[model samples]
Target chain A: MVIVSVAMLILFCMIYLIPGDPAAVALGPRATDAMREGLRIKMGLDKPVWVQFWNFFFAAWQGDLGRDVLSDRLVATVVMEQLPYTLALIFGGISWSVALGIPLGCWAAVERGTMADRIVGVLSVAVIAVPSFVVAIYALLIFAVALRWLPAIGAGEPGDIGDQLVHLILPSLAVGLGWVGYIARMVRASMLEVLESQHIRTARAFGLPERMITYRYALTIAILPTVTLLGVGIGQMLSSAVFAEIVFARPGVGKLVYDAILTRNYPLVTGAVLVTTILFVLLNLLADLIVGALDPRVRSRL
Target chain B: MTVLSIKDLNVTFSTEGGRLHALKDVSFDVPERRIVGVVGESGCGKSTLINAILGLLADNGRVDAGSITFEGEDLTRLGPARMQELRGQRISTVFQDPMGALNPVLSVGRQMRNIQYRSGRSRSEKDARSEAMLRQVRIPDAQAALARYPHEFSGGMRQRVAIAMALMMRPALLIADEPTTALDATLEVATIELLRELQQDIACSVLFISHHLGVIAELCDDVVVMYAGEVVERGTTRQVFHTPRHPYARRLLECDPARQSGRTRHLPTIPGEIPDLRQRPPGCVFATRCDQRVDACDKVPPDVAVETGHVARCVLAEAR
Candidate 1:
């Protein structure tokens, strides 16, 4: 709740910080001063900044974020329309990253100091070092343009699950690839540490199969930090998804916010920021719950 | 008959400095249904001996030349599958830190069940056996205790649970590596007592390792005294504690606070450092620290059999 409020205030402050008049942006340079002033008063920009913020904050509490100045549609509706695409992209990215990262991590740790471990170490560092936007562009060029495999632009036709899924692959890859390296490196480091821990030794001492010890005993404990990283990674992925969306020309809340910022669409921008912040907080909460379930020590504390 | 026998064990670790002679020509036997304690200071290679026996030595460490014979099989030569099969069912271990020995995330029941993974028993049967073992170790509310995490238990209780898990399969041999060192003084005695009672109940041979001489003296039937990486003395607890033949053994016993006759400002300490194990010493490992060192002490000491069962690795023992 506190985070949402803070994010809301920051978003409002951002509206003021950016050098543009929504009325002028909406009416264009041809509009007279008298007409602009009338438009500003109607849009509540004529009121004190605090008053405008308080009115918005009060209305936001009741699920009212006004409407988009350009389209005159409810800000909530516009954000909601774009939310699913961003969400699908984020979730798809996270799923593949975890699938690839965890096993790679476990394998690296098990074969530590060997060629396999070294390869994973080098690859993970390399992937993590490269910026997501660069990956986004290259991925677009290769998978979408050069290879002619996936669609290069747009989010595909709406109401078609198959089309949406096909469109989701490259953007998800661009957003999630870095996280794969991040998760792999995190899991590997954590697994190495856990494997050295006394409990792991105890398991080995008891004559448990090496496979069981690695997966059941070591991985369970090693994966805790990775869970936390995923929560934070999602938020970062949402932001980075903007680059993928812009390059891929996909419709998403991130792209919506970026376009809104350009046109000085205050209601839409604030509404999208608020919704994503809430989503980030909720995802983190889920991660904490998962951690608690996995680790009884954490559960007991909770 | 011996339940576990380590003969001519030569374990070394590769470090940045050089190859560390952590254990050299070390040999001992854990006789059936007997408790043999190995006592030494930190870095005395007690842990290395345990790891070697369990075949869980660190990647850089190896058994260069050794025969760890458990039952009729040479364990050092056993394949990983065979070693794993023998573990928990035939040989089990209780580690030093009770808190660390058990997985914190798992319930006590879950870990105990895991210990019996090779049993091919039903889950309920394992749970029932785990509960019974907990009761044997005197953990209150044994059934409920199984569901609780290690952190929920006090240190002593956790150690008791560790003991229960170790003895659950009624392993023929149990290796306890300073299991009571992490507990409080009162709890340590209680844990030792519980271990002895459980050992007797299961009739398992135990190779217990500790630096605590008092604990060894109280609980062990036979005792091995180690200095640096080599065993300096071995005998019945009475023989070693009452009549330690090696100078290092005598100094170690004298350093025990309980053995000191009266109060003094200074605690008795052997006045020298352990020789660097990266380079194996040609002479007695403890020769530099021995107050009774003679010209012959500069040579590798012979194993002098003072009695039928008592042996001391010192030239003076033979002279005496």
Candidate 2:
């Protein structure tokens, strides 16, 4: 934990040293030296880079990210208010992918030579081959604009969670579809290897129900590797939700970071990136602990 | 009453390459409390025959023509769901390698209890029954094993768990496919001894598959010798082993590395590859490897009765 704090301090220093002026990037390059220097002082960018970094770090440690330059509100206020919409999509999207992909992948593995297996195999390959951007746009064009079934953008009336869900559907489907294919194919391969195992045959020999053999004996073992992949996929989703945020016009970290980057709001941009990196690391650590708990060998060792 | 009677059984498998004749016109009966040991080379379809009996053959494989009548119901005609019901309750199997035959994730107790519960016992009743069966199999630390997964148990201990699980429902027939193959010499002897003791206690018919003639010699009352998918000899263990009438059986017993008296038991080599299932010789699958093969052996499929209760599928045995 101590090492982590020290590492973060180093990372902050290194990030600040990147070429180009925050003042020039924040205001346009057309600004004179006097204007740049004056703005830098006000923003605390005129301080030694370490001082500016420490000022932001202390504020972040206190759970106050200062204010968004343009929004003129606390960054925490923006994030906490906006996070639910993104998280709803992330949670719903992941739940749908696992529920659908696991059984589908198991069936595909168990019935390898059948038409259903071949069709699913081909579809998984096809979905993965196509980019998430293409799927999101096409879905939005068809379901939102073309049919008018769903609102094309906006998280809906700020007070209504149900309306927010309706708004999130298209973008979630878009992101989930890309990852589902890769996950399904990987699960199928693992399931295939496990189903042929002698333990599975022994389970069959014992006259356990077909479902028991397929799920308890076979699928349970096959799912461990997929569980690990799901963790990696969650990280993938956050990084890639930029497209989703843009398409849905949702107020989330993705959009906030994009805007911050464009306007060269150095503190806000750095804060967003730093938060994302920390979240990514935390998610990985949490997944590792979950997997270790699920696996008896790891659990016992720990 | 007979527990399993397989008559004129033939199993064929369809592969991308061609039709594979995995089992050819094989027949045998496993009576109540009797032990039937099937000895053969690896590819001679012993495992396939056992799988066919269990109705667990691969998608491409099928019992092409056969009648497996167990108790009163013809197992060959039973629906899959019904077959599954019969499997654990009335018929169970002990697989070849204990390491490969047990689920690594499950505690031995859970695996044992699952079979009992699945076969219609209540959870509490199932737990009692499982513990009792483990004791019956003579597992010294069965209670501790119950908390541990397959990885924690030794190979021999794993086999004991398997045997206990197989006996959970007191199945009428137990198909043991090379159950000792994964164990060391001492454990092999010990496991078969435990199995012999099990046969006495529960009195269920056990069909043992093995490549070792020595094991069959020790355990089975009846021995079935198969070569290239065909049962070349079948008889009482005494008649078949001592007064072996079939030349293939003779050559097989001769090739038994651990059989002959004296230094290292002189493991004799059979001098030919076991014929491929997809490309078996027309008249005799073993004739290619037989030293005493005659033209008549090449032309005719041999089916000879050596005694009223014993049979040998060899033309020479019937010539007299």
Best by TM-score: 1
lDDT string for model 1 (B1-320, tens) is 99888888999999999899999888888899999999999999999998898888888999999799999899999998998888888899999998888988888999899988888999999999999999998999999998899999998898899889889889999999999888999999888888888888888999999999889989999999888889889989999998989998998898899887878888889998999999767888887777888898778888889987898999999633
**Model 2 regions more than 4 Å off:** A1-20, A25-32, A38-81, A157-159, B140-147, B264-266, B318-320
Docking class of 1: high
Q: In candidate 2, list every pair of residues with a backbone clash.
A: B257-B267
Worst ten in a row by lDDT for model 2 chain B: B257-266
- State the local distance difference test value for candidate 2: 0.81
Native contacts retained, all candidates in order: 0.82, 0.72
Regions of candidate 1 where Cα sits further than 4 Å from its true position: A29-32
User: Which pairs clash in the backbone of model 1?
Assistant: none
Report residue B102 deviation for candidate 1 (angstroms).
Answer: 0.8
